[model samples]
Target chain A: MGKYLPKAIVHSDEIDRLLAVEPGWTKKKSGVEKRHYAKSETASDMGAEAVKKALQNADTTLDEIDAIICTSGTMEQPIPCTASLIHKKLAPARPIPAFDINSTCLSFVTGFDLISHAVANGTYKKVVIVASEIASVGLNREQKESYVLFGDAAAACVVETADEETTGILAAKMETYSEGAHLTEIRGGGTKYHPNFHHNEQDFLFDMDGQKVFRMSSKVINPFVDELLQEADLSIKDLKAVVPHQASGMAMRLLQKKLGIPSSQFINVIENYGNTIAASIPLALCDAIESGKIQRGDHVMLLGTSAGLSLGGMIFVY
Target chain B: MGKYLPKAIVHSDEIDRLLAVEPGWTKKKSGVEKRHYAKSETASDMGAEAVKKALQNADTTLDEIDAIICTSGTMEQPIPCTASLIHKKLAPARPIPAFDINSTCLSFVTGFDLISHAVANGTYKKVVIVASEIASVGLNREQKESYVLFGDAAAACVVETADEETTGILAAKMETYSEGAHLTEIRGGGTKYHPNFHHNEQDFLFDMDGQKVFRMSSKVINPFVDELLQEADLSIKDLKAVVPHQASGMAMRLLQKKLGIPSSQFINVIENYGNTIAASIPLALCDAIESGKIQRGDHVMLLGTSAGLSLGGMIFVY
Candidate 1:
């Protein structure tokens, strides 16, 4: 696992000044002390950096990778999937399959779960799944709720056929309740509200009904996690770590309490990174791995709620 | 397989009038006699319609599907994958996994190939892969080359575990040569060229260097097809039908000639539908199946060169 955080660090104080709010208000409301912001870096650039780091960590080269999948919530461009651009930046010696698998903020979990099946079936020997998000680009400053809750970062993992029988995905599940799809969305930049149609600038920015998303997610997450754990015949106590999406500080606290997971076992990085969208889970995973909170042979559960109002979880042995 | 065309049927003469060209010039230039243009329909609306038709053809219901994957070059909105919206429209009784797999114009081929592995491995029993493209909404009127070369349409297929021993994907391959990524693209509507930056309307429109795309594609296609055939240990003569992307009339003709596929065995729909982006290949497959050119036991090859400068092919028993 690897990650790339943009160099420009914007502290909560800076956000408060930008939003014309009182000091400490940003952190009090959003729980984001500081977050990375991209000034000139593109999502692909950050993604490539993360990929390179992952390759180095694995002691492998691009030539050994069978596929590159970009699991991003937001794209760098509308055409030619972002994975292609990342591949272009690396300039791999051979042509490998590059594509995007998007399920909003849960994209990384979804990609990891799906690709594990392929890897287990011997369809691919090794693959790189990268999640890159440039949330700073679409923030609506006037909407403090979403504006202060986003950050720019990229995370990647090199997944290969497990050499050991125990080191693979045990169980994975995803369920979408589309009734909450409207709770979080960018209304323009697509055919339904294309820019050519003269939609206003506000239409292009990110908008989220945080309260509604929380209500919908709260109603379904407990049962969804139960189903996931039941599939693996495991309980919350068996997990070494729970790396949930850094959606929000309050949501994470509520989820941990609802699931009865010990605070020591739940990974939290929103204080420094905010919600980096799809990059949140993997980024937090990387932090947990580096901090020795998770190690090889540990049973880790990746869980998240995405913009689709989807609940995704994967229990795997690292 | 099933498809849905919008109610607005646009004839070449109408395009000629819009472009102030001589009568019949539109057909002479773009080889499209008539194409569908969406007036009030959304991509998900057309996609749900196609899904319904596919479900009816398969004699099944949404309740039987294990997953829904939207493979499109364009999106209906920028958040919550398009598959979620399609699922919302269907209003499935259960929460099945819904997501997107994108590789631009080759999205449907990528989705079909990837989902086949899941089905074969028993991860999913039945899956619906839908490609919906609204190209008309992004056409640049001043650039007659791409402006007249696109249409709006949706095509879908129901893929399930094959009951017969020989009915499965024989071989599939995808390779991306990002050197030609710039040959075709919509440079905006994403973080790199965000709407907040005040990029002009042209940035969000589709742009293609037809000559470059042709030249680059021609150099790699023959060998790519040979590799696909070699993997299956079969020659081109064994293929019952070659369903290629309806990229352009000229490009398709050249590809057929280069691959030495007979005219009768090649499925061509550009004359009626133009290029539907990601929907083109599946749309052509639907037409071929409807016309009885491809049958249940026949060997069919799906091949295309997409905006990623990617070559994708899958040989399977229909």
Candidate 2:
């Protein structure tokens, strides 16, 4: 696992000043103390850095990787999937398949779950899945609920056939309750509300009905986690670590409490990193692994609720 | 296989009139006689229609589908991936895993190839892959080269475990040469040139250097196809049908000639459909299957070069 954050780290104090709020208002409202914000770094640049770190951590080179899959919530450019741009930055010695799998904030979890099967089936010997987000770019400063809740970062993992029989995905599931699709969204920058045809700046910025998203997610998450754990024939107590998407401080707290997991078992990085969109889960997972909250041979669960109003979870032994 | 086109049908004559060009010039330059343009339809709307037709064709209902994957070059919205929106429109009886695999024009090819492995391995029993594009919305009408070269459409296919032993993918490969990534692109509609911060109208439009794309593709396609055939241990003569991305008339003619594939074996629908971005391959494939050009147990190859400057091919026994 690997991670990369841009050099510009903005503290909640900075956001408070920028938004002309009280000193602790930004942190209190968003539960973000400090987070990385990209000034000039591109998503692909951060992603490539993460990939390089991942390769180094795995003690492997790009030559050993069979495929590169980028799971990004927001793209750097609309054409040539973000993976290709990351590939361009990496400049691998040989050509390899590069593509993207997007599921909003749950992109990393979705990519990991799906690609793990491909790896186990011998379709690819080794693959690099990178989740990179420049969430700071699209924030609507007028909407404090979402504007200060996102950060810019990239995280990557090197996945391959498991060397140990027990160290593999035990169960993975994703369900989309599209009824909440409108709860969280960037309505512009696509065909439906294209920039060329529409000039509303607000549409291009990130917009979210935080209350609706919370309400929708609260209703679905419990049962979704139950289904995931049931599929693996395990209980929440069996997990050594639970890496959930750093969606927000309230969501994480509520989810952890609802799941009845101890604070030590639930990974939380939002206070420092904010919500990095698709990079949240993998970034938090990396932190867990690096901090020894999760270790080899330990059972872990990765879970998240994405903008699709989708619930995704994967149980596996690390 | 299934397909959907919007209510509006646009002929080259209309384009000529709009561009103040001589009659027949649009068709002569673009090799596109007429194409469908969306008036009020959305990508997800068309994608749901295609998914419905695909389900009917497969004699299955949404309840039987284990997953939904949307492969589109352009998205309906920037958040909550298009697959989720399609799922919303379909309103399946139950929640299913829905996401997106994007590789620009080769999105369907990539999704089909990758998801085939998942199906064969029993990760999913049945999956629907939909490729929908609203290329007309992003066209730069002032740039006639690409202005009349695109249309809006959607196509989908139902994939599941093959009952016949011979009906399956034999081999598949994709290689990205990102050096050509800049040759074709929609530079805006994403984080790098976001509409909120950047107001250049030209940046949001589809931009392409046809000559550069051709030069890049021509240099890599022959060897790429050779490698694909070698991997499958089959020669060009063995393929009963060749379904290539209806990128453009010139590209199709050049690739077919370079590949030494006979016209009878080549699938061409660009003249009638124009270049439907990611939907081109599946739309053409559906036409081929419906028109009896490709039959059961036939050895067929699906190939395309996408905006990533990526070459992809899959040889399978249909």
Candidate 3:
């Protein structure tokens, strides 16, 4: 596991200066003080940097990786999945399979769901999953309410088949509700609005209804997490940490309270990092591991809600 | 098992009038006579229509699908992963997981590889793999050589866990050479050159070095197909059909001659519809099945070279 954050920090106090509007209101509303922004870096570049760190932490070489699965919410280019470019940077000599799996912000969890199955089935030896986001470049200034909640960051994980003696994923599930797909989206840059056809700057950027996402997520997340634990034959008491997506400070607090997970056991990093889109859960898990909050043989829950009005949760052992 | 193509047809000869290039040059250069273009449809709209046909062919309903994995090279929107919108169109009442997996033109094979693994593991009961492309909208007339080769189309397949008594996938492999990642790309819509940063129409459209891609693909495709058969414990003699990606007329011809596959077994539709990117292989396979060229119990080879300078081959029973 490894994480990377760009150096350009923009505090909520600076939003007014940048957007020429009121500032402190964002922090007061979302609890995000400051967030990192990329300086001349593309999403794939950030992803490649994170992969190098992950390989080092795993004590593995790039060539040992059978596949590179990129789950980035924002891509470096529209063609040739970002994973290919990451593979070029990480292991140019190795002809490994590479592709992109996207479910917006929940992309990493979806990638994990697929990779875990492939690894467990003995179809792949090692797979590197990287979720990178350069949200600063796409943030809509007019939509400061949602813009202030996002930050630029990348996280990567090296997954391999776990032996019988080792603890591995016990249960995993992914579900989506398209009814809320429009709640978070970038309306342009695709076939629907090819630059030749519809050219609107704001349409090319991110938009979200934060309050609606919170209300919608609240309805299903508790049951989603509970069902995961039940399927894994475990209880919340056994969980050392529930590393939920670092979406928003308020959302995380509400989720933790609704699920009855202790603040000590709930991994939260939105204050310092903001919502790093797909990279959120992995980055939070890295923080938990480095801080010694989660130890080997401890049960941990990987959970999140995504743009597709999606809910996914996985119970696994560290 | 089913497919759908748009009604609007734009012929190659018409390209000269539309772009004011030259008459009969597109066909003489790329062997493309005509192609389809979506009139008022988005990529997801085309994909949902295809999914409906696939469901009917499979004698299944939209709600029966456990997952919708869209592998479209071109998307309807920049966010929400295209599949979610397609799900909304196809199964609004069902809350199934939907996402997109992209490897450019080879996206379908990649989706199939993942879906097969998940189905085999019983992680998903019924998954709909859709490869939809609206390349006509992205074609850059300034780059006529590559532009003339693209067409609009969509194809889909309904896959479930195969019973032990039924024949399913024998072997599958997907490999990429990111060294050629820049060979074929749409550079603008994403973070590297977001519409907000670089708003040039050409920057948002397709770019390609056809000769270089041909040289690069020629190096690996033969072995890619051969190894797939070898892993499946079969040979070219045992193959009933070879459905290659409908990239171009000359490229397909050269590939067939090199592989020693008879024209009787080789499937080609580039003349009528041009290259449809990710939709090519499945569309060709669907044609083969409908035409009775590939029958039940027959061993068919699905092979393609994608924009990532990628090569993928899947030998399975029809």
Candidate 4:
């Protein structure tokens, strides 16, 4: 493996929970039915699994990695980084480098940039990136609106250098938006609502202004796609499949419709996966790959948005 | 001022406390005593002051910067992003792109790569980067042992394509260690410890394995610096100064000794700045420049390390 190590995609939905909320709680609007919910475990486990898979998939060992780039929105622990915790699963003597990115959903894209540059610049020979989202853990089951829209899943991508043209990722573009940060934010524990006092509980809930997020989602969807198009020197006509972030089925459909494409032209995982948040983009893209929708030469457009109101886009050929 | 933006460096007394409990607390061998500390305020304010100085030193206006990259380890509010908060302080409208980097202390190096590549490959022309840290809010200030070693500080740099051979940044590198994420970290508040429970207030405090961190720190520092040194084709003898993360006076001195450089050859800011975390690297470099310790054609090595256990080193000549 070059910059990207071996990765394995794992999804969990085995946890049994009561689906009590909003309308159509049982109905999977975007094809998303049940998402993996961690009981006592954390997102790091999912990340760890992916890391393990990536290593096994690539026939490499954890000690071989120069560094591990962890991209996720669901931060599992505070002191020990989820990545570090995951790394702890291995030998402590093999203290490989690692860090986490909080660019919201843009994390993977940012992760790609970090890994790509590291490899490009020769700081690392092999690096691993794991994208895991435990959205189900943060959203209260009581909030059917948000609950039904999320799916918890993790995907691993192993990037390695090869003469194979299709193997190396071509180009990527990742950007962030702080003006719309509050559009989808978990307003707790951060400095904004932090408390030194012991009685101050209730700061860790995932709170969001859904309508605002929808509005922001609607606004950025096209311009970014256009920017990506211009940068890649490609067009809607050239893309074989567009993997927009799996947020709401309505959002994906709207973007697809606005782009004037058949529903088949878009990858729809929400119907079965709900919204995996950051994991949704990669999960859907990889799902498209697994389902044989993608070919070796087809250009794929991956766009995602996160709770930080962050937006990122990356294009690669499978 | 002609080719690069000017910045101010500030250090606090909170550094020793950090080094004291650093994973290898028994080592008690931090090379620097003071780091940097920020007063109770928004990261943007601290960053803004640095930005203002950079602007004044560069003799430019906010409108001149095509984009601003606000880098911070401690943000007042994680939502708006420290950069966006600074953007609100500037003219909100003029196409000035802003965002923050959480690569831990390697942030500036990461920012260096982003902008350098953006300007080199993308459409950005003039870009600025701000390194600001105010980690005190997360500490148990009651524990003077930890609080005294960290201080709040911010530094700014205007990066642009200039026709100068004397003072301009050259090659840069970035890498992360997910394993190192916990080297220095706060143990609570995200998905791991559902901060919604009021009794877990202590989880919000920074919990670090000092000995583990220092050991990891020394381990990663040399290799990282070597990467940059190789990339820049510079030997230790070719460099005029080494501006490292201001973890402590003892740490810096140790690094100097390890690097086989005289104490005078090292740029020391820990005594005044404390451990500004991500801000230390850039802040110290700026201080070296302001003090005239670094001059035209001098090769400077900027190294960063922190909580995510990430380490990055880049060599630049100015």
Taking all chains together, each candidate's TM-score versus the true structure is 0.99, 0.98, 0.98, 0.83
Q: What C-alpha lDDT values do all the predictions have? A: 0.91, 0.90, 0.87, 0.63
DockQ of predictions, in order shown: 0.79, 0.79, 0.81, 0.33
lDDT of 1 by residue, A78-174 (tens): 9979999998887644689899999999999998988877787888999999999999999998799889999999999999976768688888999
Record all residue pairs in model 2 with backbone atoms less than 3 Å apart, i.e. clashing: none
The weakest ten consecutive residues by lDDT in model 2 chain B span B89-98
Alpha-carbon lDDT of model 3:
0.87
The sequence of per-residue lDDT tens digits that candidate 3 reaches over residues A1-318 is: 988889788888887577666756778766788898998677877899999899998899887889999998788889878998888887777789989999888899898888787787777999999999988888888887787788999999999976664788888888887888899899998888877777688998899988898888787777877788889999998898999988888888888889999888899888888999999899999888878998889889999998887888888888
Q: What residue runs in model 2 are displaced by over 4 Å at the alpha carbon?
A: none
Q: After superposition, how far is residue A23 of candidate 4 from its true place, in Å?
A: 6.4
Clashes of 3: 0
lDDT of 3 by residue, B27-130 (tens): 87777888888887778888998988888988998767899999988788888899988988887667789999999998999889887888888888889999
Report the Cα lDDT for residue B306, model 2.
Answer: 90
Instruction: Give every collision pair in model 3.
Output: none
Instruction: Note each model's CA RMSD in angstroms.
Output: 1.1, 1.3, 1.4, 5.4
Chain B TM-score (model 1 vs. true structure): 0.98
Residue A130 in model 4: lDDT: 77
Candidate fnat values, all: 0.77, 0.80, 0.80, 0.32
